[model samples]
Each structure stands twice: as C-alpha cells, then as structure tokens.
Target: MISSVYIHIPFCEKICAYCDFCKMFYNEKIVDKYLDELENEVNSLYRGELIKTIYIGGGTPSSLNIKQLERLFEITDKFKRNNFCEFTIECNFSNTTEEKLKLFKEKGINRLSFGLETTSNMQLDFLEREENLENTKETIRLAKKLGFDNINVDLMYALPGEEISDLNKDLEFINSLDIEHVSCYSLIIEEHTKLGINNIENIDSDLDYKMYQTICGFMKDNGFNHYEISNYSKEGYESRHNLVYWNNEEYYGFGLGASAYINNRRVSNTRSISHYLKGSYLLEEEILEKDDLVYYEIMLNLRKSSGIDLEKLYLLYKVRLEYNELVNKGLLVLDNNNLYIPEDKWYISNEIIIRLLEGIVYE
Candidate 1:
C-alpha cells in the first residue's frame, strides 16, 4: 500500500536565481487552471487509501492565496488521514500570514517547511531571494502559539562567496527558531539558472567540505541529529514524506513535474503547464528490473545515518553485496547486519555508492 503522497505546486511569487526546479511566475488564472488539473490527476490515480504522510512542496506553496490554498485543501479532503498522519506544506516568509497559517492549522496541516535559504542580506540579494528574518520569527512564533510544533527550515550554504562566518550566522538564526527540522544544502550551480547564466563559480572543494563539516558539527552540538544527508532533526521529527523517497518505497506524486514510484516503475509528470492542463501529464516512466531495484535500495537507504540492513536486502532482493571490500578500503562499515558509511566518508558518498554498486555487482 502506498502510504505517502507528494503534491507539487509549481508557482512562485519570486524566483530565486539558483533554483532550477519546475516553476513559473504566479498567475491567478494559471493557478486556478493548474489546481483543476491537479485535482483531476489525484482523483484518477489515488485509490482513496489511508495516507500516513502527505507533503505539498513548492515553488513556494505559500505563494497561493488563502482561497486558492483552501480550494487545494478541499480537493485533498477525499484522501483519508488517520491520527498519525503527518500533513506538511512548504511555506515562504513573505507570503505566509497569520490568517493563511491559521487556515492551514484548521485544515489539519501539522507541519511546515519554511524556505529561508540564507539569513545574510548579501547572500539573499546574490541569490535574488528576499528574507525578512524578523518576519520569519514572528510567523514561526504564531505557528507555535497555534499549537503547531513540527517545522523544517531550509538553509543554503557554500555559495560563490559564502564564508564560514556567514554559515554560522545562518545556523545561529536557525537555532533561534522553535523549529524541529533543518535541511541545509550546498549551492549547486545548475544550468539555465541565473547563477549559472551569470557564470558563478562554486566555492573551493576544500572550503565547501569544511563548511559542510561546520554545519554538521554545529547542528549536532545544538542537539539535532544528522539523520540523513542534508537533513537534521530533533529526535522523532524526521520528515516521513522525504523518508518515503529515501526508503525507496512506492508513492503517489501528483501535479506538474512530480515523480511517482508505483509498481516498480518510476514515473514523472510533464513539466509543461499547458500540456498538463490539456491532460498530457506523464513525461516518462521507467520500469525497474531486479538489478535496478536492488541498486536503488542500496543507494537510497545508505543516505541515512542508520544505513542499510544487509541481511534484509538479501531477503528482499536476494542480492549479496561485496561490502567487505568497501570495509577493507575504509569506505564502508558492516556492523553485523548493518552496512553504513562512516560519517567522515559520507561527503564522498556519491562516489562511494557508485563504487560499491560496481563491486557488489561483481559478487
């Protein structure tokens, strides 16, 4: 049973320079049409199964007006949620108001992911993003007053000119909040983004690695567990929706540019809004063979600090890995049944995962 659902809202009031996600300028006419198509897609695919987690991610979901958001919520009313269900929505400080947030609380949205890429005004300007830290504090305080506790704040580090001090300030600001989660990412210069177009150079690899280590150490010192790559949370607050992806479990993804994993096939919706509205939703689907599935399980599960269960992998996929070689090379560790990369080696996890997959295939 698919217990998770991810909804994508592809409209943003202000497009950041570094973002390459499927997004567009917010238009009321287009939003209304998009929501209508979104409803259709969900209704067609959803089996009315009880969902344990539902995440509405963005292009700034808070960019939508309260009424539009309400309409969106009304559509989701068809899905049944139990007491343990975690319903989260992404928000931006500029558009998230007390009234809008109050409406969300009433509608059963128990969690919020605020996109505050950086607290420094200089970085904000460089990224073509706006952040009012005071306003953010006020909004989060209001959420706490309204009995909402689970929250995730996104932070970006390792910009073209980012320094360790700048990152410390961001971390300090995050510590000030009563939020439960943090997802910090290094700036990636993706093609077609304003940053990329402007020929922004990434920070030195050594410096970038230092910044990553600094953030990890600071977050850990502040009592947050580095539960997964790029994510830290107070115990028991790890994002269930994101875990659905990291666990390599099947899920329903609805709306433009959303991807779903169902029936061992990975499917992504069309990125074009016009095509989506015209009922051409799916862009591509990949049917995973047995080898592909096992590789994915290793790739995704190893992202967590807890790592993968080797015994369970053999039972589920009947594939044995040459993890012993990885252990000999200090690239991986096998503690009885669990195969995990040491925290120090996690920075090179992408390279390590590729090598491990190659080595395991030879087994």
Candidate 2:
C-alpha cells in the first residue's frame, strides 16, 4: 500500500544561502518543460494507487506563476487520494500571495509549509533572505481565511553569534500564529553551500544543545507534541507525508534529484536538469537484501516517538534483543512492546540505535 507521494519542484525565485537541495533559478521555459516531463513521468509510473498523503517539496513550489502551478497540479490529477489526504506544498514568504493561496485551496491543498527559518531581521539579512514581516503576517491571515489550519513553519537556530534572546523572539512570534506544526532544526554548515564556501563554522555544541532544549521546553509548554526528532505538532496535526519516511513505508518520489523506495529497491533520479531534460532519468538503483531492509526499518522507526515494535522487529529479523541492557542504561524504554528512546536521550539516539542493532546477526 504505497499511500504516500512526493513531487519535487527544483525551481526557486532566489537561492537561500543555507539550502543544499537540488534547485535552479526559476525560468519560464524550463518550468514549462519540467511540468511536461513531470506529467509524463506520473502517467508512466503511477499505478493509480489511492495516495493518503502528498508533499510537493521544492526549490520553492510557490515560485511558479498561476498557469505553471496549474499545470503542475494537473500532473497530480492522475493520482487519487482518500478523504483524509494531507496534501502539502512548500512556499516561500516572498512569493506567497492571496491568489496563490486561493489557488492552492481550490486544488484541495490542505496544508501549507512556509520557510521562515528565522524571524530576526539580522539573521534574515545574513542569510540573504528578504522578508516583509507585515506581508508574511498577511499571508498567514489569508491562508487561514481560505480555511487552512494545517500550517507549518520551519525555524533554524544555533546560528553563529545568535543569542538566546533572538531564539526566544522567534518562538514567541511562531506561538502568536495559529499554526499547528513546527519544524525546528539546528544549523548544519553543509559543504557546497555559500556559508560553507565562505568558511563559516557552526555554533558551539553546548550552545546548540541549549537551543534544542529551549525549543523542546517551549513547544511542550505551548501544547505541542515533540513527535519526531525535529518536528512538533498540535494534536492530530502531525505531518502524515513526512511520517511515511520515518515509519519506513514505501512511496514514490518524482522529478530531478528525487529518490524513491519501491519494488524492494532504492532509486534516485538524475540531479542534472540538462540530463533529466534529455531523458536521463535515473542516477542509481540499489536492490535491498532482507537484512538491509530490516536494518532500515529499525533505524527509521526509532526516529519517531512511537518507536519500534519489538515483536514486529523480531518477526521480521528473528533477533531477540536483551531489553534490559538498553533500559538499564537509560537509553531505551520498553512500553507495550514498543522500544523507544527517551526524550532526553533523543539527542544521542544515533549511538544508542547502533548499540541496539548490534544484537541482530543475520543468518
């Protein structure tokens, strides 16, 4: 039951300094051609499955003009979803408008995710991001007017030279908005990004941990569930599409630089726009062995608050882990056969997950 779908739109109005996603400048001709190819790809591969969730991630899906966005939605018409579908599109503060929001509502887009990585004007300028605070407020107002309640915003902290006061202001501003979901991520200076090339360094580890703790406390006080590592949500407002990945469920990923797990294989699409335009679609394919898949299942499930079902793990891998070994170390909690990392220990979950997996030995 491949019930989730992701479509990539690799065009952005202006590139952000921190972004490392596969993206290029928005061009009318290129967008038209890409939509045509995107439609063809959907038509060719989709098995007409009823999708439960659809996430249109980007370079910036909102960068496209009305007609271009219409064509993009037209491509998605081939697939069907049920009444509980969570259809989301990523938008930028600069490009979102009343018309765009209305168009999204008309197309049955129930969720809107905005990239407001930080609210501080200084941080925004340093990231080369220009935001109109009044306009952003208006955008949220319009989205709510259009009956969108499943709204999400991304906030980045642990910035170089950023103060705790700066992060508190961001938290206060987001709490003011009636948005239901939030994703808080620590700054990672990845190679190939402008910040990386400029020799920028990350904040001190202790400072980053402090920021993370602050965010967790704030969200908890604000009646939000710290559902996943970087995600917080109001009750029943969790991101279903994102959980598709963390739950180790299969789904389709389309467009250049997209990756998919299906037919027992991990597949990635070509990252080069020229190559994709020239019909060079695939970049790599790895057929998963049973043990490889089982390991993936464990790693991904442990990322969620619900944790891994130990019985299911045993049934799948035939490995019986000594539960007390991890529980005694204050690393894992066994509740109703679901093994999970405690909230305090989620920061170092990678090391604990590695230790737990050591109990498994494939035949």
Candidate 3:
C-alpha cells in the first residue's frame, strides 16, 4: 500500500551552481499554468491510499507565492491523508519568509527542512550563491517561533577547497542551534552542474573521509542519533518522510522530472516544463524484476543505522544469510534483531553493503 507522497517544485529564483536537480529560473507567466497541470497530475494519480507522510521537496518549495502555495495545498488535500504523521516542506533561505511559512503551517505542514549548505559566507560566495546567513538564522528562528520544533537542517562538507577547520566551524555553529535533525552530505559534482563544467576538483580522499568521521563524532557527542546514512536526529525526531524511501515503499510524485514507485513499477515524469505543462508526462514508467527489487532494497536499507529488518527479508525473499558471524567479527553490530555497520565504519558503508549484497546474490 502506498504510504507517502513527494511533490516536486521545479522553479527557483536562481539556479545555484552546485545544484543538479531539475530546475528552471522562475517566470511568473509559466507558474500558474505549471501549477494547474501539477494539480491535474496529482489528482489523476492519487488512489485514495492512506498517506503517512507528504514531502514537498524540490527546486525550492518556498519560491512559490502565497496564492500558488494555497493552490498546491488544495491539490494535496484531495489525497486521503487523515492519518498523516508528518508533512515536510523543503525551503531555501533566500525565499522563505515568515508569511510563506505561516501558510505552510496553516496547511498542516509540521516538519520544515532548510537547506543551509554551510554557515560560511565565504563558501556561499564561492558557490556563486547570494543567500544571506542572517536570513537563514532568522528563518529557523521564525519556524521555532511559529511553533515548529520538528526541523531539519542540511549541511554539506568536502566541497572544493574545504578543510577540516572549515568543517569544524560549521559543526560548532550547528551545535549551537535548537535543531532537531540534520542531514549532512559530502559535496558531489554531478554532470551538468556549473561545478562539473568548471572541472572543480574534489578534496583529498583521506581528508574527506576524516571530515565525514568528524561530523559523525560531533553529532553523536551532541546527543543526536545517527539514524541514517546522511541523517541524525534527536530521539523521536527521525525523518519519517525519508524512511519511506529507504524502506523501498511506493509513493506518488507530482511535478516535472519527479519520480514515483508504485506497485513495483518506477515512473518518472518528463524533465521538460513545456512537456509537463501540456499533459505529456505519463510515458516514463519502468517495471522492476525480482533481482532488481532485491538489489534496490539491500542498497537502500543498508543506508539506515539500524540496518535491515532481518525478519522482513526472510518473509519477502524466503532466504536467510547468517549475520551473527559478521557481528562477532566486529565489522557489523547487531541491535534489536537488525545488523548495522559500526559507527567507525560508516564512511566505508558502500564497501560493507557490497559485500553483503554479493553474498546474498551468490547464495
């Protein structure tokens, strides 16, 4: 059964140089038309399934004006989401205003995620982004003032020319906040981004690894649980919306270039705004075989610190792989009947997951 929905907003005031997500500069003339079609897409695809979470992610959800946001919320209301546990909306600092945030709260959005890539103005300028640091701080303060306690801050490390000292500065700043959750990621230069076009080099591998480990240590020391590969939260503050993705659950996605998985089939909308606005986005469905599903589940679930539910694996695949020995060897740790890599091994999770998947495939 589908339990989550992802709504993508593909318009941004300006495209950040490091951003590779499908996005276009905002045009007032096209927004209304685009939103009309987006509502159509959502209404047509919703199956009246109970939604546990709804995540509005994207180019920048806060870029929409109050009227546009209201229209979008009206579309979401068509879904049967009475039991929704969390409704998250991703916002960029430059565009998120107190009034805009108030609209989200009125629409029942309980969780807010701010993409504060770094607290350093130097790094912001280096990336050609004009986001104001004070604005970000004020926005978070406003969210808290407006009675939002479930908040997530996004941090990025290992950017080109980043050093350990730079990362520690960010860590120190974040630790001073009342944030309930954080998602820190290493900077990856994807093709088509300006960073990729400029041939920007990555930080040294050893230094990058050290930075990652330092972040994990700092977050744990601050009493946050490293729940997922890139996420840490205070107790009971884990991202319910994101867990749906890691669990390989089906969801609906509405917007240009958005992807959805439903009934074992994964579908993607056309990346073109003109194409999506004209109702030509239903031509991107792909089905997965049993092996594809197995590979996907293993790769995604291993991203969680609690690892996979071994009992669920046996029920779904009817095959069991012994993990007690891996636990004994100290590479894997068992807790609550699940296996996870030790905290020290989080940076090498890809290697650990690959070995487990290889064994599962051979068996």
Candidate 4:
C-alpha cells in the first residue's frame, strides 16, 4: 500500500547561503512557466494510488504567489487521499501569510512546516535570511488560528562561529512556541553551497558536536521524543510522511531534482529546470539487487530511535544473527522487540550501522 507522496517546489524567494536544495531565486516569469510544467509532471506521475500522507517540500512552497500555488494544488486534485493521515506543506517566514495558510487548510493541508532555522536575528542575517522575527511569530499564530495543530518548526545548530549561548537562545525561543514538532539539523557545509565556499573551512567539530548534544538534551527535557536522528516530536506528532523514506518504502517524488524508489528501482528526476520544463523528466534509474536493498534498508532504518526491526529484517532478508555480538560490542541493544543504537553512539551511527550490516550479511 503506497500511501505517501512528496512534491518538490523548486522556487525560492532568495537562496539562503547554507541551502544546497534545488532552488532558484524568485523570478516571476520563470515561476509561471515552472508551475505549468509542474502540473503536467504531477499529472503524469499519479497512478491512482490513494495516498495517506502528502508532503509539499521545497526550496520553499510558500514562495509561490496565489495563482501559481493554486495551479500546483489543482494538479493534486487527481490524488485520492481520503484516508490521508497527514498532509504537510513546508513554508518559510518571509512568504507565509494568513491567506496562504488558509489556502493550504482549504486544500486539506493539516500540517504546516516552518523553516524557522534559528531564533537569533544575528544568525538569520548571517544566512542572508532577512525575514522579520515578528513576521515569523505571526505566521505561526496565523497557522494555529487556521486550526493547524500539527506544526513543525525547523532549526539548525553549529553554524559557523556558533556558541553554546547561541544554541541555548535558540532552544529557549523554540520552547516558547506552540510547536509540536521540531527538526533540528547540524549544519553541513555541502560543496555547492555559498557557505561551503566562503565559511566552511573554519568549522569547529568539537563545538558542533557539543551543540548537537545540547539540542538533544534540551528537546528531550521539554517533552519531545528524539524520534529520528534529526527530528523530535511530542508523542504522536512525529512526521508520518518522512518515515516512508527512512523505512525505504516506495513513493513518488515529482518535480525537478526529486528522487523516488518504486518497484525495487531507484529513479532521479532531471535537475535542470530548463530541461525539466522542456519535457526531460527522469535522469537516472537503478534497479536494486537483493544485497543493495538490504544495505539501503539498514542505512535508513538506523536513523530512527526505534532503529531496525529484527523480525522485519528476517522476514524480508531471511537473515538471522546472535544479538549478543552487537550488544557486547556496545553498538546495539534490543528493547521491546526493537533494535536501537544507544543515544551515545548516535554521533557515530554510520560506523555502527555499517558494522551491524556486515554482521547481517556475513551471518
């Protein structure tokens, strides 16, 4: 039952220095053409599956004007998600308005994800995100007023030259909001981003790790579940939409630069906006061998707090092992039928996950 969907919005008001996502600075004429192409692309992708979760992620979905946004939503009309458990739309502080929030609500969007990034004006400016703090506060207020209770606020930690005091300030501000979900990510200076070119050379690894630990402690103390590596939620507010990805389940990813895994094949769409608009859709496709599937499944599942399900692994891969080896090695532990990497090892989960997979493959 493929019940999840992800839509990519490739337009942005202004590209942030740290962003490496597919995005282009706001251009009115170009966006109009993109919207038209987006509709066609979506129509071609939906194969009458009743989606249970729909996510509109982006460079910034809120970057669209009312007309362009409407065209995008119109394409979504083909989807029959009457059983949809969650429909989330990602927005930014600068573009989210009461009217926009209402439009989302009307279109069955129940969750609003705000790219709050950080609470500090200094950090916001440093990222070239000149959105007014008051505006962000109001955006959340409007979302809540429109009956949106499933709100997720995104924050970042360990930016260039950040301090413990800065992280504390961010935590303090987040706790004050009526947010039920938080996705806090450590700053990764990816190669193509402006931050990578100009500022990444000066990052302090120890300080960054410390900030990550602080965020985990603060969010846990404030009644949030460290559900996934970079996501925390209050009980039932965890992102059902994203779990599809971490579980390695198949779903459709439409729009430029999006990737999808379906029917045991992984496919990626063309990244060039012009090429996409000109009808060059998918760029690559790779069919997963049994071993490849196992590797991918293990890699994604380890990111969750519940870790991997041993029974599910055995059921899918016909694999088994003596659990004692990993537990004795202090890499994994079994609790209530689920396997988990202890929180302490979370910082080095990649090494541990690879080791666990090696054990699975060998046994």
Q: Which candidate is the best by lDDT?
A: 1
In candidate 2, list every pair of residues with a backbone clash: none
Model 2 bad stretches (over 4 Å): 361-363
Q: Rate the local accuracy (lDDT) of all candidates.
A: 0.90, 0.89, 0.85, 0.84
State the lDDT at 247 in candidate 1: 84
Per-candidate TM-scores read 0.98, 0.98, 0.95, 0.96
Tens digits of per-residue lDDT, candidate 4, 1-363, equal 577778888888777888888888778888888878877887777788888888889888898999888887887777887845588889988878788888998988898888888877888888887477888777888788889999999998887778899889988888888699999988788877888787465468788788889988999899999989899999999999899999889888888898888889999999898899997888999999988888888889989998888788878888764567879888888886688888877888988877777676434
Write the residue-wise lDDT of candidate 2 on 1-363 in tens digits: 788899999999777787789999999999999998888778778998899999999889999999999998888777897778899999998999889899999999999999898888888877877466667788998899889989999999998889888999999999998799999999899989999999999999998888999999999999999999999999999999999899888999999899998988999999999988877789999999987888888899999999998888778767666658899888999898999998898889899889988877554
Per-residue CA lDDT of candidate 3, range 206-281, in tens?
Answer: 9989998899899999999999988999999999989988988888888888999998999988998878888988
Higher-ranked by lDDT: 2 or 4: 2
What alpha-carbon RMSD in Å does predicted model 3 have with respect to the real structure? 1.7
RMSD to the hidden true structure, all candidates: 1.2, 1.2, 1.7, 1.6
Q: Show where candidate 1 strays beyond 4 Å.
A: 361-363
Residue 102 displacement (Å), model 3: 1.3
